[model samples]
Target chain A: MIKKGDTIPGIFSVLFGVLILAYIKTNEKMVVMSADTYGGIGPGFFPFVCAVALVICGVLLVLRGIKQNGNVDYFQLTPERKENLKSVVMLAALVFIMLLAWKVSKMFFLCLPIYVFAVNKLLKRSWLFTILFTVGMTLFIYLLFRVGFHIRFRP
Target chain B: MSFELLMSAFLDLLTPSVFLYMSIGIILGTAIGALPGLSATMGVALVTPITFWLDKVDGFAMLMGLWNSAVFAGGITAILINTPGTPASITQAWDGYPMYKRGEGGLALGINVIFSFVGGMISILLLILLAQPIADFTIKFGPAEYALVALFGMTMMIAVSNGKVVKGLMLGFLGLGLSTVGLDPVTGLKRFTFGNMGLQSGIAFIPVMIGLLGLGEVFYQMYDYNKKRAAEELEARKINQSLGRVIPTGKEMKKWMPRNIIVGLAATVIGAIPAAGGDISAIICWGNSKRFSKDGENYGHGSAEGLSVSSTANNGVIGGAMCTMLTLGIPGDAVTAVLLGSLMMYGMTPGHTMFTEQLDFTAQIMVLMVLANILFLIIGLATAKISAKLLNMSQPTVWAAVGVLCIVGSYCISNSYMDVIIMFIMGILGFFLKIYDFPSGPLVLGLLLGGMIEKNVRTALIISQGDWGYFVQRPISLVLLILIGASFLFPVVQGILKKKKAPAAE
Candidate 1:
C-alpha cells in the first residue's frame, strides 16, 4: 500500500533509476564490446540490468503508494512530523553553509570548531562547555592528523 | 590446530609492544566506538596510516585490538542512550536500552561487555580450528564459484533483514547499481565519471558510510533536540541507586552460556563471508535465539537473552572476518578491506600460500586477537561506569561534536575535500533511507560485494569465451547456484508456511 512517505521516495527512486539507465545507454564508455571478453556481456550490461530492475521495483512501490494515497489524505502533518521536517531541513542548510565556509576558508582549524560550538550552543548546551569541547576536539583532531599521521590539511 | 601452533602463537604474544600497542588501541577504539558518528571502520581507517610507522607486530596488534574493542564498545551507546553507535549495536538498543530504563543500566552494560568477550573468545577458537581447512577447500574455487558465493552472501543478508524483503532488495540492488558508477573493472574504461576526476575511482564506502550512519543520525536526532532520548538517559542515570553487578551470577552465566555459544557459532560462520559481519550476524543470530527462547515476546522489551545474542555476535564476528582476510585475499567487510590493503602494502598476498608461507605472521595475528579480547575484557569492565555515563552527558554537545568528527573522518580518508562533499551527499541519502524505512545494511553490503560480483562474472565469462554455461558447468558453481536458488525460495516458503500456520493457530 502506498503512503505519503512511500510515494515521494518511490517516484524519486524511479526517476533516478530511469535517468541512470538513460545515461548508461548514451555513454559509450560504459558499454565495452570486444572479441576477447565476458560471454558477450559488457560493463554497461549489469548496470543497465540493475537500473531496469530498480525502475520496475520503484514503479511497483509508486503504484502501491498511489493506491494507498487515494484512500488517505496526508496533507495534515502532526507536530512531531513537522518538527522532523524542520530538523532535517535546518541540518541540510547548516551542512550547506559548512561546505561553503570550508570551500572559502580552506581552514578546518578556523571553521570547524566555530560551527561545532555554534551548533551545540544552538541545541541548548552550556556555552562554556560547548566552547571548551569544540576547541579541545579541534585541537585533538589537528594534532592527530597534522602531527601524529603527518597528514596535511589544506590551508 | 596443533600444540606447536598454539605455543608459537602464545610466544608471539610475549612481546611487550603487542600488549602495549593493543592497550592503546583498546582505549582509543572504545572511546571512538562509544561515540555516535564514529565506528570501528572509521577508527581502523584513521589509525592505519599511523600504524605504518610502528613495528609490524605492534602495528597489527594495535589494529586487531582496535577492531574487536571498538565493536564491543558500540553497545555502550546503544544501552545508555537508545542510539546505536553502529548498526551492529542496533539490537543492543532494542533490548539493552530497555533494561537500562528499568534501572538495570550497570547490568545491561555488564552483560554487553561479558557476552562480547564470550563471543570474541569463541570465534577466535573457531578461527584457529577452521581457517586453514576452509582456505584449503576454497583454493580450488573459480570465478564462477566466487560469483555465486558472493551473490549468495548478499541475498542472505536481504532475506534475513527484519524488514520488508522487497525494500531491502531494492536498496541492495540500487547500491549495486551505484557501485558500477566508476571505471569498469574488466575494460579499464571510466563508466560514469561524468568529467569528474574524483568519480573515476568510485566513491569510497568509508566516507559514504560515515555520512550515512554517523552524520545521518546526528541530523535525524537534531529534531526536538533529541530531548526524548536524552531525558530517558539522564533519568536512568539518576535513578540507579546502585551500579548493580557488572558480572553476572554464576547461575545466570551458566544459563546463557549455551545459547551464547550457538549465537557465537552462527555469527562466526556469517562473519567468515567476505561480504558479511557483525551487523548481519547479530541480526540473524539474535532473531533465531529470540524465536527459540522461552521469553520470545520479551525480546525487544528487556530480555537478557536477546541482549546476550546481540552482544555476543558483535565481537564474535571479528575472528571470522580475520579468518577470511588471512586465508583469502578478499575482505570480510569494510574494516577487513583496510586490513587486506595493509597486508598487500606489506608485500604479502593472501591465498593458499598465506597459510604455508606466511604461517608465522598468521599465528601472530591470531595471538593478537586472543590477547586483544582479554585486554578489552579487563579494560571494558574497569571502565564500564565511565562509558555507561557517557550517554548521561549533554546530548547537544556530544552529537554536535560527533557531526564534526564525521566530517573530519571522511576527509581524513585521503585528505580530500571532495570526500567531505561525498559524505554530505551520502548523509542526506542515508537520512532519507532511514526516514523511508529502507534498510541501510543491504545497501552497504551490496556496495562491498558489488565489485566481487562484477569481477567474477566478467572473469568467468572471459575465461569461457562467452559461454553462458560456464556458470553452471563447474561443480562448485553449480552447487553454489543451487544454494542461491534455495536462499531465494526459502523466504517465500517460510512466508507461505507462516500464513498457513496463522489460521491454524487461530
Candidate 2:
C-alpha cells in the first residue's frame, strides 16, 4: 500500500544511489579490478554493490509509496508545527553562523558568545540571564578546552 | 593469581595519592559521562597526556577509575534525558528514560550503578582468572571471523528497528554507503570524497553519533513541545522533587542478578574480540536479555532489567578488553588501544610473557580495576539522587546547554570545524528520520561496523584467492556464520510461534 510521507525520502534515496553510481562510472580512479593485491575485487566492488542495493530498496519504497491511497501535502504545517520548525530553524541558524564565522575569520572565540547569547535568547531567557549565561559558557569553554586540556584552536 | 602479588598491588593502590587520583578520576569521569558529546574513549584519550607526568601506579589507577566510572555514569544521563551520554549507553536510553518518565528514576539509577559494579567486578575476575584462555580463543579470529563478527553486530539492526524493518534496513544501508565515502582501505583510492580534503577520511563517527542521538533529541523535544505538555512536566517534577528509594528491593536484585551476570559474561567475550567495543556489547546483551527475559514486553518501555543489562554490558567490556591487550598484545577496542600505547610507554610489552615477566604490574592492573569499580559504585549510589536533580532544570535550559555542548564536543574531537558542519547536517537528518518514524540505531551501528566489515571481508577474500568458501572452512568463522543466521531468523521464528499460540488460545 502507498504510504503517506514516504515519497520524498524514497526519491532522495534513489537519487543518492544514482549519484554514487554515476560518480563511480565517471571517476577513472574507481577501479573494479587490480592485480596489486590478493583480493581480486578492487575498491569499486563494495561501493558498487552498496549502490545497487540502495537503488533496489529505494525502488521498493517508491513503489510502496505510489500504491498508498492517501497522501497529504508534505509542507502543510499547523500552528504547533510552525512553532516547532521556527525553533529548529533558529537553533540551526545560530550554529551555522558560528561555523561560518570560524571559517571566515578564524576567531571561534569571538563568535562563541554571540552564538550562546543568541541561543539563550531564542530559548526565551531574560536578557540579563542570557548575557550572563553566554559569558559564563564562553569562559567555561575557554577554561575547559584551551586552558585545562591544552587544545590549540588555531586554524 | 599470586596472593603476595595481589596483596602488593592492593597495598600500592591503597596509597593516599593513588587513591586520591582514582577518586578524582571517578568524579571527573562522571561529569564526562553526563555530558552528551563527551565519551569514555575521549576522556581516556584526553587524560592520557596527563598520565605521562605521573607514576605508573597513579597514572594507571586514574585511567582505570575514569574508564570504569565513565561507563557507569553514562546511565545517569540516559535516565535523566532520552539521550545516551556515550555510544555504549545507547540502550540505556531505551529503558532508563522511560523508567524516569514513570517516576522510577531513582530505582533506575540504582540498578544502573549496582549492575555496572557487578559487571565490572565479574569482568575483572574473569580477566584475572581466565585471561590466557580468553585471549587464546580470540587470537584465533582471522579476517573472515572478524568480518563475520561485524555481520553478527549488524543483525541487531532488525531487533532495534522498533518494528519498522524496511525503514531500518534502508537507514542501515545508507549508513554503510556513507561510511564508504572516504579513501578505500584496500586500494587507497577515494570513492565518494567529491575532491573534498575533509571527505578523504570518511564521515567521523563521534560527530555523527552526537548529532543523531544528542542534538536529535533536542530537536525532537522542540518539535513535540507544547505549553500544556510543558506545564504537565513541570507539575510532575514538582510533585516528584524527592527521589524515591535509590536501592532496589532485595527480591528485585535477586531476580535480575543472574541475568546481569550472564550478560556480563557475554559482554566479556564480545569485548575480547578485537574491534568490538562496549557499544556492541551493550546492544547485543540488551537485545538478547529482552528476547529471553520474562519482562520482554516491558523492555523498551521501562524495564529495569534492560537498563541494568546495558549498563553492565558496557562496563563488563573493560576487563575483557584488557584481557586481550595483556595476553595477545592486541588492542581489543579503542580505549584499550590507547591503553596499549600507555603500556608501551611504561617500557612494558604485551604478550604471554606479560603474565609471567610482568606479574606484579599485571596484578596491579587487575587490582586497580576492582578498586575503580568499588570507588565508582559508592560514588554513584551516594550521588544517584543528586544526579537525578538534572530533571528539575527548565527544559529550555537543558536545550540551550546541550545544543552548545554538542557543537563544542564535535569541534574538540579533532579541532576541526568540518566536524561541526557534519554534525549539523546529521542533526537535521536525524530530526527528519525521527519525524519519518525511522530508527537511528541501525544507521549508527552500520556506520560503526562498515569499515571493519569491508576491510576484513576484502582481506579474507584476498587471502583465500577470492574463494568465498574459505569463510566456512574455519571453525570460528563457521560458528559465527551460524550465529549470524540465527540472529536474523530467531525473531521471525519467535513471532510465528507467538502467532500460533495466540490462535490456539483464542
Query: In candidate 1, which residue ranges exceed 4 Å CA deviation?
Result: A1-3, A32-38, A70-77, B1-21, B28-63, B70-112, B224-226, B244-267, B270-314, B324-361, B503-506
Please, what is the TM-score per model?
Answer: 0.84, 0.75
Per-residue lDDT tens digits for candidate 1, residues B389-502, read 554455566567667777777777667777789888988887777667777767876776687788889888888888879898899889889987887777788899999999
iRMSD value for model 2 = 2.4
Residue-level lDDT of model 1, residues A38-152, one tens digit each, is 5678888878877887887788777777777555433334677577667667767777787788789887678877777667656666768777888888888788777877776
Tens digits of lDDT, candidate 2, A64-120: 667753574444466987898899888888888878887788887887888898888
* DockQ, 0 to 1 scale, candidate 2: 0.56
Tell how far residue B477 is off in model 2, in angstroms. 2.1
Estimate candidate 2's alpha-carbon lDDT, on a 0 to 1 scale: 0.78
* Per-residue lDDT of candidate 2, residues B158-181 (tens digit): 454445566767776887778788
Error of 1 at A11 (Å): 2.2
Interface RMSD of 1: 2.9
* Highest-DockQ candidate: 2
